[model samples]
Target: MDQVEKTLNQNRLVLFPADQLQPGERKLVKVDQIEIAVMNVDENIYAIRNECPHQGISMIYGSISGTMVTSKPQEYQYGMENELIKCPLHGWEFDLKTGRSVFSPNQVSLHIYDVRKEDENIVLYLRRSPEKVIVQDFSCNHK
Candidate 1:
């Protein structure tokens, strides 16, 4: 009998198509060997690290809603929309524009990346080393 061989390669995951998401939806995207959360806030797109720094949870899987659309501000801004993502576990609110944690006043922000639409595809490039991996735990990658 011959032993079966198995190996895991990360290059097999498909993120999403450019048109799969609409304005106000968030999608988990992996590109350039990086995992991130892509969000379409009022037609403008944003890409940030999918893992929440607080507890290393996948922010993409969390409960996300447009803060501007759901909770309107007292004063209106020129380019402001409901684009805040609230963590379902701990209820940490983050502003999609700056990726800053609203729950923290001291500039706790997520790792942001440069995302653009190229022809018919949405592309995201790594801005820096991924601080946390949302798909796996800190000490384990077995999953």
Candidate 2:
């Protein structure tokens, strides 16, 4: 038997097995000295920074839930369930997909990385610069 070849990309990190983290589960991982919160929200995996913009607390420990929204002035509607991560200390909620603050989107935001399922491995791409987010997909570039 021969050894199976893995990914050649240096920026890609094999976080864990796909079966290890089920839907609605969260795992805290560190890559290049940065703490990241990898969550499986209804099987749509999302990765966000563990640091909160407010008090610099660990966001991974924050409660996962939705907030109330309203279109009319006097109406209140609950929306965006399980898509927001609250700051454990300050109760500030941030969207997992966009990594932006719910109340003040432009003012505060978390650094989010690209994540996907590569075969049986859950991979995350560590992005150092904003412009170099996706220069190319190595897996697609090759066979």
Candidate 3:
């Protein structure tokens, strides 16, 4: 077998059948000590942490929407259609592709996992670290 196949066979955790998941649907799964929310958007599969960072609420029941941008007053732009998942408690939105929070893109984010399809099964690979946290400099310049 190849390298990917070897890794899959070694650390792959099968969640469910690929055909059972439909577009715009999410499934909650527990592997080891982590809770993951597997989502299907327009036939693409994505997985993220099921707990919200703010209130520890379940993010599986969160709503999905497109990214909304407002340049100025009365001007609104909507892009990245069906790619954002909003927290159910405080309405915090996170990008499904990168797991970056819409409100605080540089700081807070979710633990996104890498998913793959293996012979009709949906598999989740084990990550070295459960979550990736990035810290940015917040200094200001005075002129």
RMSD of each: 10.6, 9.5, 11.6
> Model 3 misses residue 62 by how many Å?
0.5
Residue 66 in model 1: shift from native, Å?
5.5
What digit string (tens of lDDT, one per residue) describes model 2 on residues 65-130? Answer: 888986688888899888888887988989888999988899989878788877877777753411
> 1 or 2: which has the higher lDDT?
2
Q: Would you list the clashing residue pairs of candidate 1?
A: 66-82, 67-82, 67-83, 67-84, 68-81, 68-82, 69-82
Worst 10-residue lDDT window for candidate 2 reads 134-143
Show the lowest summed lDDT stretch of 10 residues, model 1.
134-143
Clashes of 2: 0
Decoy 2 TM-score against native: 0.77
Estimate the TM-score of every prediction: 0.58, 0.77, 0.76
Q: Give the better candidate number (2 or 3) by lDDT.
A: 3
Q: Assess the local accuracy of residue 87 in candidate 3 as a C-alpha lDDT between 0 and 100.
A: 87
Task: Encode model 1's per-residue lDDT on 76-115: one tens digit a residue.
Answer: 4333335666665687877766778866736687777666
* Regions more than 4 Å wrong, model 1: 1-17, 31-34, 66-81, 127-143
Model 3 CA deviation exceeding 4 Å by range: 1-10, 70-74, 128-143
